[model samples]
Target: MSDYDFELPDARIALRPAEPRDAARLLTSYADGRLEDRIVRDLPQILAPGDRLVVNDSRVIPARLVGERLRPAGTARVELTLLVEDEPLRWTAFAKPAKRIGEGDTLRFPVPGGVVEGRVEARTGPTVTVRFAADPLAAGAMPLPPYIAAKRAPDARDESDYQTVYADPPGSVAAPTAGLHFTDRLFSALAERGIGLSRVTLHVGAGTFLPVKTEHLNEHEMHAEWGTVSAATVAEIAATKAAGGRIVAVGTTSLRLLESAAGEGVLAPFTGDTRLFIRPGFRFHVADALLTNFHLPRSTLLMLVAAFAGLARMRAIYAHALRHDYRFYSYGDASLIFADPR
Candidate 1:
């Protein structure tokens, strides 16, 4: 635990989608926590010619499952959100109506092939274990964050909108949302302008949106996320650093992978799990800027923002956002934060 605590109002919550991908507002903050406001479409205007924008390309799988209860007659309707798929058949999930759902309880999902079945193998509070009847990846629904609840459950439309064009490796339970702003057109435009793009992969997982309940920051436990930093990306980052170009991570997921895999002293290649909980005192290894969405209050994401920008500065910026009615969360508005080495 750390002493990073703040308040965010309910009204700041964004309940809908931006009309155009880039139509949403953008807020960029300096290392010292200075803030500048701009629209997402104008991002190219503010960025320098040599800046490198790194994005996480991890694809978001459909992880939300809707099905009827099969055990104990008259079982109520249930929703199971998959947290991690161990294989084609096994998974760890967080289920609603978790009380009656226990080991061996049968669950089902709809698909053209028929019902995708599963069995609850474990249960703890709201979380549950699910052993799937088939490949969970092919049938699960996109686990959209609670704040951006959909009018209807995830469908084919989310197949494209919730994922970035560059997504490759499929592992993340949640989308690396800030990347959602970059249309192929926007990316092409930036590329044409010589604004370099880089990539890192940190599979977004269950820990990302969980609330920080403990008052003592040190007691907070971070969940491990799998990540990979390619050698080519490392070399590109080094070149960017050497040439005086800013390394702008597209999302906090990319930022975490970069910082966890590289060194404060110099960039390096890495592959492993990261439970790296970045706080105020942590020195950054990669990234000079961040493109992200506003996060839940009392969440680790907010803590990360607080660390990037000073706590007080972030507070003011967030307050301004709240006052101006900026949309918040995974499908919400975006922010461009500059990470100048302090």
Candidate 2:
């Protein structure tokens, strides 16, 4: 995993996205190690007419909550970022000051009508399962990536800024950042050029931000996230392939879900939890091209991109991005990588 590491300047991290979204710079990398610089709005020029863009349309919910934990001694400030929904009202969350929280302890969050309470039901290391007294969506804050959150706090604007223009199925705690660069105008432009657009849903989990702790990549445990690919979309993918159209996944989530649904070398309708993890040397079954944002150093996301774009080439690409001052991480610029045919 250390082989994937690269030096990134702190100044390259983007605190906010490009104002028009589509104005974000795009870096294109090809199978033969060729590179081009473009902008997000130039997708129509970058992609062929018959190519299809498979995007994740999972909506981001306000999953971060600031509350006070009621303990025997007194009340302590606790911040919770909801992860997977284990039950109707129960969510697995990462609690700040996890050591201070205990099973059965109640947390109170002040909201519009009344205070929403959550009682801790169980613990697995840093994660705790909390059953909410009311719907968390009503008062939860937007769960921003910690890298961004550490620099500044989430605000009213993030409720809109953090989500993609096409997001509809409200479930994910995190935004599929690659889709963030798209705008209504860009969508119209792509459609006008005959670039087909398809949607999949992957309720991105907060666990996506967790760092890999194992020395060997294979030893890392993948967190399960729910996703769905409709029968109609599967047919579209097949039709695209039949016509020699490229399957361009908009983000890692879409790529993972598409690969997960591809059993026996073909895509089928699917709706379930997927714990798929892509690393270098993994054979890709669906995506021919990928549009993604710059990822963290030595992170699984980077590994996945390396797997798609090739390791040495990805290193060169990242070095070029850094040299050009392209933004890094969730609010960053974009990259278009064509998979190696080999």
Candidate 3:
């Protein structure tokens, strides 16, 4: 775990996303140990004509909420970030000031026209199961990563800035940041270059933002995220691979789902929860290349890239990114890493 740690300056954190989306910087880390700096729009030139880009199309919902716990005397303020829909109208959420909330307590969240209410079903640590009288999505705000939300509150801009242009199904609480770099223009350019695009679904949970607290990597437990790879997507990938095209995962979420579905060394249709943790020594059957954002030091995300592109290579990539003044984290620069053949 210590080997994955690196010092990052506070200034490198991007408070907001790049305008036009495709204008963000892109760092290409090749298998030959060469690094090149480019922008997101240069993807068409970087990737080969036959390569297929598999992207996560899961849309982010308004999951962060500020509600009041109706009390006998008055009301206590509580903050909750919905993690997953355990059942219909029942959600598992992480609550701030959890001590103020209890099982069976009523929580009232303000929506556009009226207030929506919920009853706490259960509590475990900071996580609580709440059954809402109405869909809570309407009463919440976009759940920004804690690293950014701690500095500033989510605004009207975040409702769009935090989501990807190709977002479809509404499930994820957090956006697949890597996909945030793509725009309609970039998609058109990729198509013109004959680079095919495919879609997967991975509803990112709040657990993605949780820091790895264990001293030993083996002891860490990964949070499960719901995802699916349709039969159509499987056939698309198979056709691309058959044509000698590379599989370029647009984000870690897409990579994880593809890898999860291909666990038997064959990609297949899948729909379920996955706690697949990609670290060093984990054999990868899919994802020839990965286009992702710079991750935090000692994070599972960092470990993942290191596994894809040798640890030594990823270290150099991060060093170069920091030295060249590239931004870091969710709203920062992107990196296109080719898998290490070794």
Question: Pick by lDDT: which candidate is best?
Answer: 3
Compose the digit string of candidate 2's lDDT tens values, residues 229-302: 99999999999999999999999999999999985677899999999989887888999999999998878898
lDDT of 1 by residue, 134-169 (tens): 876566677877665544556666777788889998
Clashes of 3: 0
Clashing pairs in 3: none
lDDT string, candidate 3, 233-270, tens digits: 99999999999999999999999999999989889999
Sort order, lDDT high to low? 3, 2, 1
Candidate 2 vs. true structure, TM-score: 0.98
Model 1: how far residue 68 lies from native, Å = 2.7
Error of 1 at 49 (Å): 1.5
User: Candidate 2: which stretches are off by over 4 Å?
Assistant: none
Candidate 3's error at 38, in angstroms?
A: 0.8
lDDT (Cα) of model 3: 0.93
How high is each candidate's TM-score? 0.92, 0.98, 0.97
